[model samples]
Target: MTTGRLLIVMNAGAGHSQAEASRAAIRAVLDAHGRAYQFFLADSGSALPQQAALAVQQALAEGGAVIAAGGDGTLNTVAQAVLPHSLPFGVLPLGTFNYFARAHGMPEDIKAATEALLSARIQPVQVGLLNERIFLVNASLGLYPTLLEDREAYKAQYGRSRLVALWAGLVTLWRARGRLRIVLEHDGQRSKLRTSMLFVGNNALQLAQLGLPSAQQVEQGALAALALRRTGLFTVLLLLLRGAIGQLHTADKVLHFTFQRISVRPRLPYGRRRIKVATDGEVGWMSSPLVFAVAPQPLLLLCPATMETPA
Candidate 1:
């Protein structure tokens, strides 16, 4: 009952001029292949649910695959809808930071990427769950989320420039002051601490000790957590400098740890005043008492066969 067709879900407003060019090239490849695929556009990827349900149902009926043609957020939406049904998922990498695509060795060239998708191998990828919602990458809180929200506005005015984002983040961090209570339980020990930022990854990225030029693989059975404590302004500046140079290996105030499961409860009460949470650039505010757990092998992804090689 599987169709040979493909479903391409696009967020038309994801990236800049180059992203548009990539889209055109992808269209050409699909046309040349004579592939039966539909292009569904949504203004904001939040509207994906309406188009995704039907596209998924049709693709399932026809034995087709669903391809996410934008950024990580768009891909996350497609994954949310199709993962439970066991449909294969592919990425087109037409967004600002295509982490998933880069991690999987997907080509940045639109035509080449499409061609690779035609024959790419698939493997199960781990997903993380907070409450009932699933996150493909990592989820973060505290200063980082505020920075993301501010950067969105900044990008609106300055386009997708990393410099603008950096400036906005620095400004936000300067004015931000709050402590987040986190309780982490793993390896038979529980610790409670206050931090400026906390991040939990479905898979860990191995960088050259500089925290850059890193690679994140879908770990089949584990979860990773990072906790950043409050630091003096001078230390924060040093960390920023190292991060910019991609040499951020050690920051005395930053606590990086990995665990299979962790729980976080804000000392503050749950309300609109709650802290914001972010996952792969998507931002939202959440109330206190957030539970995070590993959803092992929750979804299947189409990736290059060579990715299975040991890193």
Candidate 2:
């Protein structure tokens, strides 16, 4: 490990007040531990992935550790830069959900999370690939992607909150229509299906919470895919209710599969070259016939040594 300062790449606009407090808390913890660090804040005008990639390069060149300090979206952006070099990845867990960090046994509190970083152990963690990009949690297409879009718009207009996000989802489901007709090719066989939502989870604990099959260790080096067969608003509502109650995997309309890699494409040929996709709470565009795969190697994550598997 480098004796230099830790390099922290943070998204300036996310959770402004919380981020400020967390930054102070981080300073306090690192100072008490006698560690040094530097900050790289991503501004509104900066292209995030590009800036983060540059920061990663600079950090690696200086023989320092790089930490991502924001939500899953920010973490995913940073991961894109770190994965290529196989650098040690650290997390500050300043995001809304903090799924990736929390799933890896990172505490949500700013001070504790920073302590975890100071006493970190390098552990191998699996990451999922959506098209050419990396996703730490899960990715989805069709209605779920559209729902994420709506949620973001709603948050931007009405201010973000858990209840507001839930309202946005309800409004989206009320107006939702159309099922994506596509073929899923896995293991030498292809299945034709029409569904409103699809979710690919990298964390097995998250899958198990949704009533799906999952191993005790999410680092098992595989991905889990969930498909919903119905597009009706009421059915979607019912499924959401079941998910809220932890019965989604047992629902008759849902299908689950585990795989090393899978391919998805529209059944009908189209002139368009790309489709809107969502991964780890961020939305973007990708070319058709999107291929999702698990990287053969694991990311070196800075996790606490005493922290066990996800509960």
What lDDT does model 2 reach? 0.80
Tens digits of per-residue lDDT for model 1 on 200-284?
A: 6654442322363222323436556666677755667788787667566455666665555677775665544466788777887
Q: How many residue pairs clash in each candidate?
A: 4, 0
Highest TM-score, which number? 2
Runs of candidate 2 exceeding 4 Å displacement: 1-4, 215-219, 308-311
Q: CA RMSD for every model?
A: 3.2, 2.2
Query: How many pairs in model 2 have backbone atoms within 3 A of each other, for residues 3 or more apart or on separate chains, i.e. clashes?
Result: 0
Quantify all predictions' global Cα lDDT against the true fold: 0.70, 0.80
RMSD of 1: 3.2
Query: What's the lDDT for candidate 1?
Result: 0.70
lDDT of 2 by residue, 28-76 (tens): 8888889988877777414677767777887778877788888788888
